[model samples]
Target: MPKPNPANLFHDLPDKLAAELVNILVETPSIRIERIVSTGQCSDAGFWYDQEESEWVIVLKGRAQLCFADGTPPKTLCPGDHVTIPAHQKHRIDWTSASEPTVWLAVFFSA
Candidate 1:
């Protein structure tokens, strides 16, 4: 398997993105880390991510919004912002910055 992730998270991004890009940075039996780049991407209508693993995510650049199934207002995240979603908690991406790519670091692990 290829061993290297990019040396920099902000490098090699295309000027226009047709969809969000996700790259696995690390993976083990119980944990996975990902680098996600979103350019004006949102979850498909009525789609929610309901994963069995807990997720802790941080916004490394740009901005985005997360919507939960509990009907609370979407939470906006900018650089330096972070949140943890417990296992099985339904959520979806509501918005992302269109003018720039939003970089996110996500760690998922079995709880």
Candidate 2:
């Protein structure tokens, strides 16, 4: 088979978002990789994300704030910042930079 073409994570950002963009870059039975682009979007108040799989996420560009429902302090992420969230941990994106599109690389896997 021919070699697969590679992609740049920082290029070709989506325009005119009705919501945050979530693009699955790779997937398997046990793992999934995603590229997420956010333009000043935040989760709704009193809402939280509870995922079955563990997640490791990194900020590739711009900035964002993440908060957990368990009273943990919110985290501010800039370029190159990363965090690991365990399964069933309630969390949400509190804020994303309005000045530019925030790019995130997230990996989800079964533990």
Candidate 3:
């Protein structure tokens, strides 16, 4: 089989409250692929992901605000923004716009 091209795999998914399309590696073990995530607006829910796993996120379109659960001011994320979540850091999606789709790329890998 030919190698997968990251550019060719990119896509925008439908907009829904819990809509998330895994265009790539959806069922692969030890890794995950999430595209076009509409994080929405809520500050009370967050995940205490396993510390042995690290996440790399990129904002492909629209905007959002991400804040670690340590009383830090939210950081604005726009198109082309990228951030890496450490293995042990607990974070949350502080806010995201409903006016426009906030497309994001997330790759999770074990440390």
Candidate 4:
């Protein structure tokens, strides 16, 4: 067996921001892990994410707001906050802190 690869989650952050940067840290048949860096990014109006896989996401740095299509109050996520979104749930990023890059760790898995 080979030695397991080691990495720091906060390493290699992007300096310029044209779009959200997504890096896949791990992928297998049943699960995928990604690191997302967002600097003042949000979903377009009337748009939502309808994913086939369930997702568990955590904010590693900065802050964000997640809104659902059901009219519930948007969930505010600060650093160290996390939420699990069920498959097919209509959700979108409403806002993110612009002064600093918001770092997120997202894990997607089969339901």
Cα deviation of 52 in candidate 4 (Å)? 0.3
Per-residue lDDT over 1-110 for candidate 3, one digit per residue giving the tens place of the 0 to 100 score: 97766664344344556644445546377888767557364445655343567889999877888878666666789999998888877777767877766788888887
What's the true lDDT of residue 88 in model 2? 94
- The ten-residue window of minimal lDDT in model 2 covers 2-11
- Which stretches in model 2 have alpha-carbon errors above 4 Å? 1-6
lDDT string, candidate 4, 46-89, tens digits: 89999999999999998999999877779999999999999988
How would you order the candidates by TM-score, starting with the best?
2, 1, 4, 3
lDDT-best of 1 and 3: 1
TM-score per candidate = 0.91, 0.91, 0.68, 0.90
Determine which window of 10 residues in candidate 3 has minimal summed lDDT.
8-17
Can you tell me which runs of candidate 1 are displaced by over 4 Å? Answer: 1-5
Output the better candidate (1/2) by lDDT.
Answer: 2
Which candidate wins on lDDT?
2
Clashes of each: 0, 0, 0, 0
lDDT value, candidate 2, whole model: 0.93
Instruction: Show model 4 residue runs off by greater than 4 Å.
Output: 1-6
